[model samples]
Target: MDIRFIPQAEIDKQLYNSCVHFATNGSLYGYDWYLNATAKEWDLLVEGDNYVSAMPLPRTTNWIGRTQLTQPVLVPDLAVYSVKPLSPKRIQAFWDAVPEEYRGGGLTVEPASVPKNAGRFEVTTAVGDALFLNKSYEEITDDFPSTYYEQLARAERADLLPVPALKPEAYADFWLSVHGKSVDNEWKYHAMQRLMYQVLHRSWGNAAGIQTRDGQLLAVSFNVYSHNRIFPLFRAESKAGGDAGAMTLLNDTLLRSHANRSLKIASEALYQRSR
Candidate 1:
């Protein structure tokens, strides 16, 4: 049960590999490329000699000089990633392993991973639900309500074609135009949008979109690919797109198209939830 801490500044291939192997969603968000690209340093928790179990500690400081730990974007909640669910006692040990300095700090944890008898840490409801794609296209299409079905049908008739090879700038620019005013006017938000587009150029994922027959862009999404899962990051649609049901068509098409492959699309709550 030996535990070692690796500062975010010193993370390397070895540590990143360990993270990818041990973390549940490692393949998507636990790689050096992702960590470096995001430019947000995250400390690592390694167990035993080779990182048998681990978790990331994403760190940041506020303008008021108060340092806080927060979850990175486009990632599900962090977990004490391990070979199996940690027992109540081990979960407590994991919590204790956090540098005493961070013990009192707030961090996000997967609700399921937090043992019932663990610590007295506060747990808040997650802001969003993630859609884990497991069902087939036929299954998905059949289940969607009439509203979605009607949207898809109209979007197609509107002559808005799917742009599977959508460009990154197109997606970023569109989002900024529509939603940037609502967010912090900081450079970081803008920079992250650029970085997301840059990453889209890689084989890891793609920038998907939909456009009218006249080539007017209506919607775009940057889907990050890793470990056979596709997370469509920042999917957005224009007024025209919304009216035409461009998103409904795009998403439904993806689900059906990738049904043969082992690929699954994880969304931030596209369907209903029980928890």
Candidate 2:
């Protein structure tokens, strides 16, 4: 139950890598190769002989002399990554091990591994979506709302075909055109999102794209995979793609292609609006 906050440089990379490498709930977000690009500093948590968890804390200072730790963009949930699925007691123990200052700034972790009723900190939840391959691809297709099918068919008719992969920069350009150009906030996170592309480019994942007949990019899909799960980290579509459901068709195409892998898409964010 003892936790030590060893600085990233001082931490043993081999042991830490092994911790996440063998973690039951591991994702690319927990890996150094991926996290290092976005986070400057992180602390490893150790329980006796084992490196149990790692926390990447990206801190910033304001002109008003206020400094605070914030979760880096492209990293959704990276609190304490444990080797085992976090139980209530383990989650509490892990937090108790974390220093109080580090605790207050709020951290996010995967919904599946989250600790319920954490002590004294106000908690919030965001609903997400995933698709599992327990059923045949055809059966899974049946589960898609009639609208998904309708839009997908329309996209196909318009010749928005799914290709196995696309360039990260191409995807970013399209993403910015759709989200950043249209939104008032201007999606300041696009920089971080693009950095994620470089990180993931070296990792075990695949990118898919939907394009017009002349090869104009419509939508891009970047999904990272663990042993048996796929995390649909980010997917974006242009207005034309959105109008024709290019993204939906792309996702379905991905599922159908990978259906033989017995993979489950563990998404906390569902693709479509729920009625």
Candidate 3:
């Protein structure tokens, strides 16, 4: 029950990372490498000597030059992951461990680890769809609308193909080319590219895309494989690709390949909630 804030330099990475690696509610977002790529600076909040419960506190200096605790870009929310479902008191203790200056920052707890009551915490629930890949491909596809099949057929007719493990640089450039206007700042643009390279080069995740017969890129996604789940970091589809159903085809191909694996694809709703 002893909870303390450990600065980044002071953290015992071996113990802290092991806790995050094995936590039932873990995700790539909690990993040190991930925080290193996205956070301006960060530290840990650990529950005990064994590091049974933990959270990563990411910090940043705002545009006005004020330091603030914040979540990383492209990350929807974070959690106080633990060995077991923590009681409200334990959860509160973790919150109480936050340095007073960082108190106002918010974090979202994993659905599995959240308690029924949160003492003194303003708890709110955000729900999103997840594609559960427990069933056979056919069984899962049976629930899809007829239009999905039609899109797949269109993609097929257009000779668009799903290509796994897309090259990082190519995909990043394409992503920025297609969506750069939407990204308002140079920092965010660089952060997105840095995250893509880190996730792909480190083998923590992969980039998949759809391409034409001539290998022209059309649609792409960066999927982080962690916590026994697939979370998309960035996804985009060109108009030509969308019209040809390249994105739909790419998604179906991914689902089919992983069908019956008991994995979940974190939905677009989940990934884009913070955006």
Candidate 4:
């Protein structure tokens, strides 16, 4: 068996086409888009003749964070791999080949059975989502106290915060500091950043940072966009003070702006773990 690394962008159309054909008839979620989005950060492993596999490598440093709640490990799309049916031994061997540094991180494996002309092909898909927030804004805000709205109104009247906008480059150091807090894992940082980028680029999402009256960053929140539905992916507050209420205020303001629409708020899984 020989293992070859191919840039994700260079993968032949036939391979993707094949995957799509199988995906259409398979139970996999987001299969078609997954196959199409495979990029240079992904790899394909081939055995003697019939078996094939696709693996995704860590492509960014957003997953790592000092605080468990702040980490980006749960964003559903980090490192993943898709493979045609192979024996347990081959599967184990394939994982064994991964560099030790990358092997022990947030790697996940999912297996699917796809029927091929020759016979049956087992497709193993692996990825990780440390936290997934897909609920509407109302669902998200339900967790906070009712007084939160009053505080948000105050903040807005005082002009004490910046509007949440997509500021990818502005938060570089903030992201790095969060990543540095991790004890052993570094791959998480990449996942975190990817999640942030995905949210920022989506027309349905917006991100903003909150600062204290003294101009210190108090928290950051990613608000989902929708006419009648809203979701909050990541919402965090600085550890320097007991201003947890600030986050609640941020959410209140967001909800008020979209009060005309039905809203659901969701948070990363890590948020619950941290609390």
Candidate-wise lDDT, in order: 0.63, 0.64, 0.73, 0.42
TM-score of each: 0.81, 0.82, 0.86, 0.43
Backbone clash total, candidate 4? 40
The candidate, 3 or 4, that scores higher on lDDT is 3
Q: Write the per-residue lDDT of candidate 4 for residues 74-181, one digit (tens) a residue.
A: 333321223454455555555444443332333323432211221111233443232223445566556655466565554565455654444644453454454465
lDDT for 164 in candidate 3 is 48
Top lDDT prediction, candidate number = 3
Off by over 4 Å in 1: 22-27, 37-39, 62-66, 84-86, 115-136, 182-202, 267-275
Off by over 4 Å in 3: 61-67, 112-126, 182-185, 267-275
- List per-candidate RMSD values in Å: 3.7, 3.4, 3.5, 10.4
What would you estimate as the lDDT of candidate 4? 0.42
| Superposed Cα deviation of residue 156, candidate 4 (Å) | 9.5
Q: Predictions ranked by TM-score, top down?
A: 3, 2, 1, 4
Instruction: Please provide, for model 3 over 1-275, each residue's C-alpha lDDT reduced to its tens digit, 9 standing for 90 to 100.
Output: 78888999988888887888898767777777667767758888998888898978787766766655675776676678788666777766776677866644454545644545544444444357877889899987776777888888888899887774567667767777777556354455667678877776767778889999888889988888877788877688888888898888878878788999978876432322111
Q: Quickly count the clashes in candidate 2.
A: 7
Mind giving the per-residue lDDT tens digits that candidate 2 earns over 204-272?
A: 666778888888888787777774777765667888888877888877777677775678776553445
Better of 1 and 3 by lDDT: 3
Off by over 4 Å in 4: 1-72, 76-160, 163-166, 175-180, 183-186, 198-202, 226-229, 267-275
CA shift of 187, model 3, Å: 3.2
